[model samples]
Target: MHGTSPPESQRNLSRGLILLLATACGAMVANLYYAQTLIDTIGPEIGLSPGVAGAITTLTQLGYGAGLALFVPLGDLFENKRLALLSTAGAILGCLGIAASNGPVSFLAASLITGICATGAQVVLPLASHLAVKERQGRVIGTIMSGLLFGIMLARPVASFLADAISWRAVFLLSAGLMAAIGIALWFVCPTRKPETKLGYGAILGSVWGQLRRHRALRLRAFYQAMLFAAFNLFWTAAPLELLRNFDFTQQQVAWFALAGAGGALAAPLAGSLADRGLMWWTSFGALLMLTLSFIGADVAVAATSVAAFVIAAILIDTGVQLNQITGQKIIFALSSDARARVNAAYMTVMFVVGASGSLIGSATFEHGGWTLSALTGAAIGGIALVIFLLFDRGASDPD
Candidate 1:
């Protein structure tokens, strides 16, 4: 799979190609999250109840879930790069719809569109894996994955700042422009990689069910990711409210707190390198344990007024979350080189949907039981994730 010492020029070109692909994927994904930073302003602007405001995130998650089931599998039958390009074009239109919206209903409709189209990132990940040399696969994939993590984590703060200075709708306008640019870049830059299988659309959809039955690793990885993402989502979903009520925090301040999680994004490359070094299982196990411990710090942060505790917990939780994500992807990419995109689509679709539900549940729990309830619930979920990891034999199947 690896070319032994390809010409330096070829290696350099591969690196450049990976970077461009990452950048395009990042920009497209940022569209799905733009509404998150603007949810508060959008709710009041559109006269939505607080609970309904939470639906903004929920709706996007549901749309992504639908896309994962409906669109991601097309990577196996359709041209992968073309799918990415078309998805980006669709995302641009979705962002425009959001920017033009005059009410919550319109915004909700647009949000769903954005989520459906934003699965471009899922398609692109497999494209990256396919492009990588075998020996450098994990590190190369990790480098690109880091770029993606940056967009997902930082888009909120960046969008929030933009919305503060401009209108919330302006955030969507900027995203629309970025998506247009990405679609064009992808058309020029992405390598043409077609599917090897001749599975018809009906056969492709049926394959997912067959894959589920045959691939226990896929199921375990998805469930593990689901629980871990739920923990991560629960914190981000509920922490802002806790800060606003107890610490008297402002939205900008809370947005800035996200920077603490950027440290976690930086951990992706490191985790990927570890996976390349043949420590994938250990890295995953250790990261899961660390995430479980972070829940303790998370509980402590609940009532504490000290900035130190909150910051520390944020770093631990975010780092653990990002580590789990990178490690899980490394595992899946190794597990199914033949159908990497569908594998990722399975894991991410379930995990993200879990994340979306965790966010909604976090809010409802906070409303009823306050920060304590939210923190404990998150910690409990993390603990359960660790248990599942422990029960599964990491060596049950050989890495592809």
Candidate 2:
């Protein structure tokens, strides 16, 4: 198919269609993360403590990892539209459960289900990849990823605002409604393509495990992303409480911090564009330098009462993390287009698992040592990642 005659429409979707698909992926994936905003609200509503409530996030991450390992490869074995539609439906059901949950157990279970269903976003990306030509794939993927990053970045503030205004439960219901709408749209609009392989689910899933063993690039990139994500998670998971406890900021104020990070996410397209220009080395160097600077800036911000410093730190941290993720995806997706979903599964599974661990470590450290210690730990990890990258044997960050 790579060298075969190309269809005109499949050559590239119109800009509008690409944006629409990207937005859809963002909306669908947002269901998995909206809980972060609602967690504080919903926890109090259900009488759960902050520590216990965090399990919702942990469970969701674990579920996402599991889905990446087991469910995403189905994209190669089933129709993309069918898989996305079904996943959307499942997400809607999961959101409904979240909206109705009355206890910790129910919330955790609902989150796990939503995490699994959110693989729709992963499936859709590879499908979009297949639709685009090679030359434009970077830009196309970058455009779609912008939506995904926005979904993740905006979820915190949006969820916090919605939870503060209406009810936490209402947020999940709104997401469920959106999921239904997307599912309906896909049912009618998405192309009907058949499976690439006739492998049974057993074989398909086993192949995921097999890929981990066989693909050196996949393993390396996954581990790298995992380390970076751990640091990213540590900061995000701990910062809110640090602000609330030390600076006496409101939830709304903390939510606003996410906006600054989103500004950073906007750099993703620029990073991709740079990669296309064969300047990824410079781009990465700059991004990591920004991250280091942010840590220094954060230290000053903590010492003073200036929110501006925190804002600057957020932008730098997010920029570095977003760039790393885009670069990682670009490399892994290039490995084997046929197994893009599996590759994504492997990458995301490891990334999120480490992210969960980071959150746990951050929270635990914060409980004992406070924000400074947590921040210090995060900075150390980020520095280690930088060292690893510098010492890495690959000529470029991408080891294709």
Candidate 3:
């Protein structure tokens, strides 16, 4: 009775709404990643040097980090349906700008805007968690997150396939159209969720730091996920380059490799079920171990030029990262019922900022020392995260 609550009927998450949220999350989040696999193709066309082309992925992720900081906190200040739709509309405009850009500067700017607006996916996640009952929150979040992970994993291959069939610009145009349709559909389907707080915009935004300070579990879980995500981004960002250069893979073949990586999305619901059973500690430990080992395996495969080894490593890495992310969200979402959005904003803003740096670091490492160095860097980060979890995460437990 103390927190914001809709009517009892409105609290139940209908199957239709669940599916709609999943689809919308997938479509919106896909915009941030489509440029990643196309950097090679787009760079020559736009007259960008290799270094500048590589920065495209980093810039897009940095834009998403900015959006998470600035816009995601608004979920605590406005009706969620309207907030989601507004962000979606911005994503459409950004997509169109990306499609229409004729040069490197314009393209990079549009990429940033596209990344910024893609925070709609972040907003949708917290809204879904808020709508779910306490007992079912992990499952609901996992189901929605499965869709998001799929989008992230599949976007590269889909974009690569499209780029091969049509042109790189066409990928953004198609995404713009898809986002517009999803936005319109979501406008009609999502329930209104009005926050009960009377805090001003400045106060709500200012409260994020306070929330971080107050929640030690939030900080630990966020740091754990951030390190896993950084490694995750490092692998995917450099993988395309490795496949194309070392393996002499065509874009379509690289797409198939990405398709293989999508298998990792399967870990989300399992992680949710594990958290529900109070197995969060073991799950988190296993995920970190898998991530570190996967990178080590990937380094060996890259050195030996073994495609099968690379594919296996990709699956393990993706699965490990997804497991850590779902487990972390389950813990953090239970921290504060009233301020879930702000808590999530704080959590993800830190994660994405670190992840954006991973992209830059991955690119630079690959450019200088090739895939071997990149894989070692990722493995080392994963190892550090595992150590932090063991040494510092004493209070990180599943909520009773």
Candidate 4:
């Protein structure tokens, strides 16, 4: 798996390598989330009113979407290890810049750059797929996804606690260091995967839209995950607000409540295994149902002001979201063997760009109507996805 390695250079992809790749994916994707839970604390310090703080979250997601379209497809045309390192380098700079930001514009710009460069996770995942044997594709993707999901889950709690213990700026500063280490590790350990595609950069970019339009499964899965991810973002963005406002929870308490969602990371490996066993549809159905139920339960918890119930809802919602995401990734990654990165870019761009709106939507809804309204919006999103799954998914093992 070097500069001159063939397509089969790492067909039997080792566990240690998988763990390293998984760690890299998790650490990079975690940048998209550290801002989410800290919106309350970050907004004021950077001179943004509460009304506009969520903009940072949206900007970060938008950055990721921009990267998916603008950079991730390069994984197919360039050496994956070097490309990921380049993206990582950019993310490191973004993190460092955020740690030093003094105004709203500077902070927002840094957030966007961090989000965009965070697509190093995107490159790394496809790189893992390049090495994975056919039978192990789902499992490898799932294992890596577990790390990404855990990173998503862990980031909020970690940020909350870090902000509580030291300062919000420390989170990004620490992350900058982590990204540098991971980038170096990737450069040294990961085998170089030069995509076999002969397509030029412009040609690959052009093929992205066609990839989305051409693949039925890709479209369906993108839509499904988009809805669920919106719910996921809305919950994380709004839940802390409710905690601080209604329950008078301290930042440490909020961290503990947020930590509940970390349990959801377990769903990734399990969902991947189920998809490998041809139960993707059932797994997706269950995931959607769980999400709807979790939202319903969260509404109840918010109304009752019960932290325990809120914790349960957090775990369930996060699990449901991860389950559907892993299933969708397994499906889409199988859609185009030759165009994995482009198809992945298309699938993720649709998901994150649309899903990013959840922050704004949730913030406004919660401000006017409270968590009850927020929960209703999330439930409605989850319910719609469930209906679409029922109508279109049937009992099929895989998409056509």
The top-ranked prediction according to TM-score is 3
Q: 1-400 in candidate 3: lDDT tens per residue?
A: 2245666666789878887888788888898889877888899888789977877877787788888888998988888888899989989988899888888899889888888888999999988888887667777787788889998888988998898899988999999898888888887878788888889989998998888899999988888888988899899879888999989998789899999989999888888888877788999999999999999999999889899999999999999988888888999888887787899999998888777677778889999999999999999999999999999988675565
Show pairs that collide, candidate 4: none
Sequence-dependent TM-score of model 2: 0.90
RMSD of each: 3.2, 2.7, 2.3, 2.6
* Candidates in descending lDDT order: 3, 4, 1, 2
Tens-digit lDDT string for candidate 2 (188-230): 7665545567678888887876777877767766776787778
lDDT of 2: 0.76
> Could you tell me every candidate's TM-score relative to the true structure?
0.91, 0.90, 0.93, 0.91
Between 1 and 2, whose TM-score is larger? 1
Please list all clashing residue pairs in model 1, or write none if there are none. none
**What are the lDDT figures for the candidates, one per model?**
0.77, 0.76, 0.87, 0.86
Q: Give model 1 RMSD, 1 decimal.
A: 3.2
Per-residue CA lDDT of model 4 for 1-400, tens digit only, reads 4432345656788898898889889899999888876888888888999989868977897798889998998877888888888988999999998999999999999999998998989988987877887677788898999998888778878987887789999999999999889888887878887767788889999999999889878888899999998999899878989998889988788788777768888878888788788788888989999999999999998888788889889999999988888888888887777788898999888998788778777888899999999999999999999998889865433643
Better of 1 and 3 by TM-score: 3
lDDT for each residue of candidate 1 in 280-373, tens digit (9 for 90 to 100): 6777778787887877777776666766678788787777776777777777777666677677777777787776678777899889998888
Clashing pairs in 2: none
Stretches > 4 Å off in candidate 2: 1-8, 44-52, 102-107, 396-400
